[model samples]
Target chain A: MIEPIVGRYVTIEVQGVTQRIYFEEAGQGRPILCLHTAGADTRQWRHLMNDSEVTKANRLIAFDMPWHSKSLPPEGFQTQEYLLTTETYIETVLGMVTALGLDRPVLAGCSMGGRIALQLAALHPDKFNGFIAIEASDFQPAWYDIDWFDRPDAHGGEMGAALVSANISPFAPEAERWNTLWMFMQSGPGVFRGDLSFYTRDDSLIARLGQIDTAKTPVHLIVGAYDLTCTPEDAKRTADAIPGATLSVMAEVGHFPMSEHPDGFRPFFIEALGKMPEPAA
Target chain B: MRSTLQTMQARLNASDHLKHLGRLFSETVLIEVDGDEFYLTFEKGAMVSLDAGPSRKTPSRFALRTDADALQKFWQSRPAPGFHDIFGLVKIGRGRIDGDMLLLVKNMRFFKEFMALGRVKAGADQ
Candidate 1:
């Protein structure tokens, strides 16, 4: 039985939709907003929440994306067209920041969360102190080509069910399966479709990588040697494109390396966080 | 391949506890597979195999199998949810645990810490 940590739930208005947001705070320093992957909620960071490194130095904030976990899906939420888009995600993040009174929190994201973090950094550079992207890539949009809005549901076809299942963790506990399923349903068919849509699209940050002012803030690219979803090669390319972007790869790890090898991942993450510049003197 | 295995055996034999454990067990094997390479070191006490695969090898009592790609994901995202809640969804390939599930669970923390140190060492060398 996982109990909710010390946190509060509030509503944020984004594009005329009232979205429910849950957040927890720990320690006291520059704020670091930890974003979760696409199919997961803020619960992903539960382990880090208790880490001495996280609790002793930095203020940590983690939340579910719109329509995830405790967050309610907005009316007419469409995944293919709207759920994972840069604009919608950025707006929700901005709204949450405004609601919480956080000033320029450093953003850290994993997989889908990483993509959102990059988009936020690129689109709204004023809102973040720095950005950390874990196993993320600018190549997602090129992986698939399907109209997510028109895609079928779990009951519709095998491909649809498989696609939907792919987003959720295959190693998820048995007890949470039904609850996760319910969350998926509430997220509607559009959410996964939107993810596929976003993943397969070609709008990338590779070309603009050099434009990012890494000297003013730290940008760290951490990857696992065996991540099939976002290959280390992709990470290497992205790192090479960005000026002074440090890349670290852990051996004997995979797509979800943090969970697969938590013992190894923490030190590099801590070192990266330590390198973050203090907020403008 | 056999020479690599011999080298690994020499390395393990050099460890006092492992050498002692080797005398107790009838048969054991220590295999490390990374990419296209495979190395096997057979011992007696406890059979352990660690697979960082782009290659395949025989299974053993305790196996920690992952690849470079997955390692990156794990590093970038620590403390991921769904393991406790969604284990079935994860694919645990190239891994085998032949005995003492309870013992494995008990020593999981130590094993994890050891592996963590191994990763750091590997990173530093690179």
Candidate 2:
């Protein structure tokens, strides 16, 4: 059985700008705040949001970042030079958590979102109850070049998708595959690349991972076996860097696990989310 | 067609990634378009020169062979699953890289960016 999901817009002033962010919510119980991948939006968690079992015991919330998916840019914000810095990204997430008044909400994020999740847990140790990270690493290989994004095709459609096409394994379901693929295809020029500015270059955790007390804020790292961008070895290295962080490698799926292979990723998702102490009353 | 590719040399040399990479590996890559060849000699990540046929001082490390249509489509930012990337094109039997496999593997992304310059330029062409 699955639960009906509701979508809504949140108005929050972040970094001195008023942003109308888009988010979705379903079910009720302990709150599980989900962050989506880079170059993507809240749709990544649609499967989890729809799952009856997940929504039954927990309140699931997912949001689209400014300039991503259905979320629009702040008025007067230059759309061309769009860049998401580490500081701004953190601030936005914190803004969402605070606006919702969620106490120690469990956080789950994938890829760009996943890296942010780990960083959020590490930076604000007491803010989160637990975290489920998917397809994330402190640093990724540089060869996955994205300079093509600086100059886009007639519509900036194709190259962005090509940059990570192989990351989606053939084993993924047809709908799942297209769902993930179309996100990249439809992205505005430089949107995906701007997001990568953080994913590949800006987000640094080597000096900070040691600061994360995994005992206090439980960290569950779930990665795909076929993720070329951030290999399993990379996840292992990241897990090794963090104290007491547990790692689970999902088979066959690649970078976009939540959207690409939710069924395969569900068990780990359940195990990790189920362990989080219920949200404060 | 060579003009389009030849134009990308400056963009590649100007790249922070390539400029930084050029400082690391001083190698030559031979790009064969149709039957014609252009040897891109790099010192560090900077392209010292583009020579048609062959060069006297430096020898190429590997040769990447692709046809005009494939290269043009790639340069158009067509996206992957098309012939947009070296590996993607290789998968479809549209292109091949011969010579030092390790060198190609070592600087895979660097070469990817280098090739993408043409595509970038194509995208920039209004």
Candidate 3:
């Protein structure tokens, strides 16, 4: 049975500064670290967080990155402009793992988090057990005028979300649509644009795809049919580059699948966990 | 054709959603319906100009192309799939969003609101 969800804050040092990260945990067994999409907090993983069976035997944990959700920036680390680079992002996740003492836990993330999941498995093939990437890819072929995010009178984060909301399947239920919109509206200003820099420009797993040992750290790429930004073909291409990497295209789902269609997306997510080699039995 | 363009421009000027568009400005997009081409230049979230055959001064970061009928359908009520949004139209093969993807993604809301103005005209025409 799934236990009650518990929330906590982990204080870790990044860039010679102390930062507090907000995270939620439930169930207990093999550690499962969940990361959210760009500009989105851990709320996207609500289904997995509350799953009765999945959480029953697995330690499911999700966290908000600094400058996102409740993970506010370090004291006196004042910078009006907030950007997350590949280095900063990976380092923070690694910091969490090290601090929590999770032993090569399975990593699951979507969009920006998905991008990180692929890199973590590749860079330290022995460090992670598996990689679950959703609506993510090695790289995006498009570029945008980022300065637009800094323009006066434009709320870049919210405006960016309106575009992201487009990724939601038109058939999404009203509750799911409102829930997604509420989270998007609550995100910190300019955070979405900052996160996209890492997702869209900074991180690319193409060159390092061969470095991943799928036999050890299996990779599963899941894309939704309605996620036009990162099409199913994109995930297929990324999976093909990595030997043994598996790809699944969900029907009627979109970019933010887990939350937008949690019940519908649960089975596919569970199947991914099923693929993970039993943790060091 | 000119009447449609003028209607779109007028609606853009009156829209509170489009009037205060942030980070989405400083972009000039070329709109091509059939062989008719023109540019919409945005600055600080407001549509500053709608000129003939694109703007030489600002040029166009991206261009959209479709026939007038499709454009009309896009402008009218979005009661069906494939005719709702530009990306939707692109997905169903009715429209194309090409050139400078950054502008397209970063300023997408600006575009969406700009197009959704068609709802007003749809009500008027009916």
TM-scores for all candidates: the values are 0.59, 0.70, 0.77
Ranking by TM-score: 3, 2, 1
Q: What are the C-alpha RMSDs, in order, of all predicted structures?
A: 13.0, 11.4, 5.6
Interface RMSD of 3: 4.0
Better of 1 and 3 by DockQ: 3
* TM-score (0 to 1) of chain B for each candidate: 0.34, 0.85, 0.82
Can you write out model 1's per-residue Cα lDDT over A51-156, one digit (the tens) per residue? 7567676787888777666666766654324436666777888888889888888888887777767667666777888888887776654332344333442221
Q: Is the docking of candidate 1 incorrect, acceptable, medium or high quality?
A: incorrect
lDDT of 3 by residue, A136-205 (tens): 7888754345555545565666666676776776556659866876777777777776777777776457
Q: Where is model 3 chain A poorest over a 10-residue stretch in terms of lDDT? A: A141-150
What's the chain B TM-score of candidate 3?
A: 0.82
Query: Relative to the unseen true structure, what is the C-alpha lDDT of residue A57 in candidate 3, on a scale of 0 to 100?
Result: 88
- For residues A1-281, could you state the per-residue lDDT of candidate 2 as single tens digits? 43488988889988887889998899888889999887878888889889988889989999999988788877875635777888888889889999888888898988888888888888986888988888888877455455556562233444556556657654577689778878877776678878888887864776788888887888888887657677688899989998899998877677888798888778888988866666555
Scored against the true structure, residue B21 in model 3 reaches a CA lDDT of: 69
lDDT of 3 at A158: 62
Query: What TM-score does candidate 3 get on C-alpha atoms?
Result: 0.77
Residue B22 alpha-carbon offset, candidate 3, angstroms:
13
Off by over 4 Å in 2: A1-3, A78-80, A152-154, B1-126
What is the alpha-carbon RMSD of candidate 2 to the true structure? 11.4
The DockQ of each candidate is: 0.02, 0.04, 0.23
